[model samples]
Target: MGDIRRRWTVTARARSDRGPNGLSLLPWLLMGMGALSHLIQGDAPNPVIGGLGLFTFNTLYIAIVVRAFSPCHRETPLTWGLLTALAALTFALAIGYGREWLLLFPLLGLAVGAVVRRRKRLGRITVPLVLAVGVVTFWRDGWNSFGVVYGTFISVMVTAAILALDETVRQLRATREELARTAVEKERLRFSRDLHDLLGHTLSVVVVKSEAARRLAPHDIDAALAQVADIESVGRQALTEIREAVTGYREGSLATELDRARDALSSGGIEPVVRQSGPPLEPRTEALLSWVVRESATNTLRHSGATRCEIKVGGTPERVRLTVTDNGRGGDAATAGSGLKGLRERVAAAGGTLDSGPAPRGGFRVTAELPVETQASQEWETTG
Candidate 1:
């Protein structure tokens, strides 16, 4: 809920930072008030012509500037055409009536900046436009009018830079949101896999031990009682593991899982052959391999009607390999299970590969090869 509120606030802030709009450009229209005042005073000749020119420039300026703020219309030929017409009107008026009419050049620059974003294009337009503004201002107002030229230059460059910055900020925000969503999905996948692996193995062990106890209960009460006691121990360990899995801190040990696998296989009446020979592994790698061991043993007990199972773990300094094979009728149930699929995802994420198929001798085989320095974590995904 807090995260949701934070996201909402960020969205609101982003909206508020949306830069200038069409309405914001309206205030620059006030710059034409000087010409309006001169016309009202009736101090100039050809009053009707001057009034028409001023009205036309203002109309074009408003239309072009407003369109410049809209992404859809900013690049259309119509917008460029309107801007061109406004530039022609501004230069004619500045040359015709010296003082206040020349102020429209900076407004023209602002419109150009808003519409053209690419630096190369903006440079081409501004350099020529600035040269024209300087020449016209010199002819009409004189050499002291350098301020007009400088103002036009600053207006164009600064407005373009600001709008470009706003665009970049918006892109960055979109990227951040996408990354956050990906993180949440990864964590969800990790939790689901952990739960499936923990429960799948634990339930398989419980089912096997229950069957063993039921068979021994009739004649060997002591043996049956021992089996029941083992069930209680398995149950308690499962409870602890479930708590750890929930908290996302559970780490599996290869040696511990191998011992449990032997017990589970023996209870299911399958001879277990376990072997390990490798340099000490990183905790992350061992945790990954332990999950493989647990899932394989569960499948062997529940799916393989085999009399024997062989589990081998061997590695060099750079790579490690694990193979679980059972002398059963291909153990199709193991290959079809979600547990292997999930393990595959975890291993692949850690830069490893997992393969499951029938062994050459006509039994099911599960093989996994990982870099010795694997970075796979315990909370990684498992399908089942």
Candidate 2:
């Protein structure tokens, strides 16, 4: 969940970085121009009513256009009221004067297309409603009124198409944002796993060797001195590994990590048992399994008060699996620490799954499964 929140934060920052140039009011300006042209050229029998009608129409048109561009697509009651008033005024102008006034009906269609909340409902209600108004107003003129029909048809079709194109662009932008977020998340997981694997293993070795030196200080000076020397050596090696990890050049192998886990567990006075029965794995699979071993060992040493730990590896022609279990004091696996969380993301990115929970008998268990031939798994194996 922290990882997810970080990704969203990065995405928001990226959008903000693009600045004010991302949006422009030019399209609305063009729409206003086209709508205003109707009022200037349109015929008005009763100047007062016609002028008032044009003003209301233009005001409603602006409101509808603004709402269409809003992130939310749903219409409010105020919008419905505006549309209803516009329609009534358009109808009055058409009936009192001439069908030329009916041309304004097309603007109403455009407004309907822009302002309606639901698409399916818009298709069912708005389209038929607009068509009916156009037909009823022009029915007296017969087939000779081609201008009225063409104008109405063009207005509705063009406006609806524009709205659809706008919607498509919105969906594309959203998809692009999701992809960016995923990429950021994957990179963060990689860095976290590298740091945890490096430091956790090194620190566990240092702690164990330090304890041994303290215990042996009086019994045998030579043994105590040797343990101190070993601790120094381990600490220096950890420093080098930390540097490599930070520079993103460190890599782990399953065989090496397993050996290291055995040494760390033995130093901590815990028995280590490892079992393996797998076909040869690709380097990527080996690397991922290595990190799993490293993290599990660290957890057992730091948190699990266990006496024995078991690491198992097995594979079939189709998939490979790794499991780490310990006879430790178990806790809620759902609330795993950052190391396990990073492991989950790493495994998932490789087309694999990781499951951790209380073992059926006792203690805690972590399992990872990776397909033998997925593209993502193959890519991870090669690069990981």
Candidate 3:
């Protein structure tokens, strides 16, 4: 029941979102005009019964219009009873008076509009029921077949088409909402992965420096003091990096990450070698590559037991590449972590690819290739 209520609420909101002022009531007003014309035509045996029937039909018509346009429109036992009574009244008026009373056929359409709220088996149930009503009401005159058929066709078509359109709009709105949720979830995952990588690398450096200070405290007081100072500096830097990341102001550059990676590798007792053979890159491309370096360095420190690590950056005119290789116990396909997965998503978003595997000569290698010439770059070149 709660699910049904929620669905109805969503449908109502979608319908209301169609326009600022809400759906136009012009059609119902036109229907009122047609009902007035039936009164003006003066084709009833008794004016009193005709007037009463007219009033009842118009009242029920207005009720139907209000219910159909309502945002919270749902079926209830009372509503069902009202629709049943209206149908009975309509049939009674047509039977007692002449066939002219059948001009109130729009009331049947209104009933159908209400019925569809509870059951959408419109073709199987409502359509046939409406046809049966028409047959019973007009069976007295063979010539009245055309009016019955035309009336039933118009009522069914109009009601079904409007309801279908409303359902479609509701579906589209739901799809848009779902897509928005997915985008936000992806961003949250990216932020979490970045935080993990940043803290993991920073804390590892801090731990190594603290351990060095502990070992050297008695032998060389100056060297121990220097290690403690380095630990303090690393902690402060980590704090600042975390602040920047949380505020969405943190942006990585290739040069900065490479320098930091070198320091981290050397602190972890691994020799670091860096090489570059690329022209200047766009800021976005640089940031993406910087992230690749950061994630790779973190993985090397945490997973790879290596004595040496090498970083390479190279590119042609069309694309740029970054490779981080470590002469460590190599990782297999199953060893890829969340940091690597996040890196893959980021690189792909920038129209790039990331590949990681055990290198041929032993150890693990991570490679990222990003296009140098994006749409913005092409436009700049053309304009220049």
Please give the RMSD to the true structure for each candidate, in Å: 5.2, 8.1, 9.9
Determine the C-alpha RMSD for candidate 2 after optimal superposition of all C-alphas: 8.1
Model 1, residue 312: what's the lDDT? Answer: 90
In angstroms, the error of model 1 at 331 is 6.4
Cα lDDT tens digits, model 2, 1-384, are 999999999999887544222023224334334334545675444566666766776676667666655655336677677777877776666666554556666666666666653557767866676566656665745665566656555666666666666667667877898999998886676677787677777887888878988998989889889878888877887788778776777767788788878878887888898887656777888888888888898888888888999988876767889888999987774235688888888889889999898899899999999877633322122110
lDDT by residue (164-236, candidate 3, tens digit) is 5776777798799999999898768867977987887788788777777888898999988988888888899
Candidate 2 residue pairs in backbone clash? 284-381
Give the TM-score ranking, best first. 1, 2, 3
Q: Among these predicted structures, which one has the highest lDDT? A: 1
Model 1 lowest lDDT segment of ten: 375-384
Most accurate candidate by TM-score: 1
lDDT (C-alpha, whole model) for all candidates: 0.86, 0.72, 0.72
In model 3, which runs have C-alpha deviations exceeding 4 angstroms?
1-98, 108-169, 215-219, 333-336, 374-384
Q: What value does the lDDT take at residue 357 in candidate 3?
A: 90
Q: In model 3, which residue pairs have backbone atoms overlapping below 3 Å?
A: none
Best of the two (2, 3) by TM-score: 2
Candidate 1 lDDT, tens digit per residue, 1-384? 999999999999887767668777779878778888888898766779999998898788788878887789998999989988988888888888878777888888888888888889999999999999999998888977788899899889988888777767777888898999998998888888888889989999999999999999999999999999999999999999989988889999988998899999999999998888776778898899999999998888888799999999886667889999999988467665688999999999989999998999988999998998643322211111
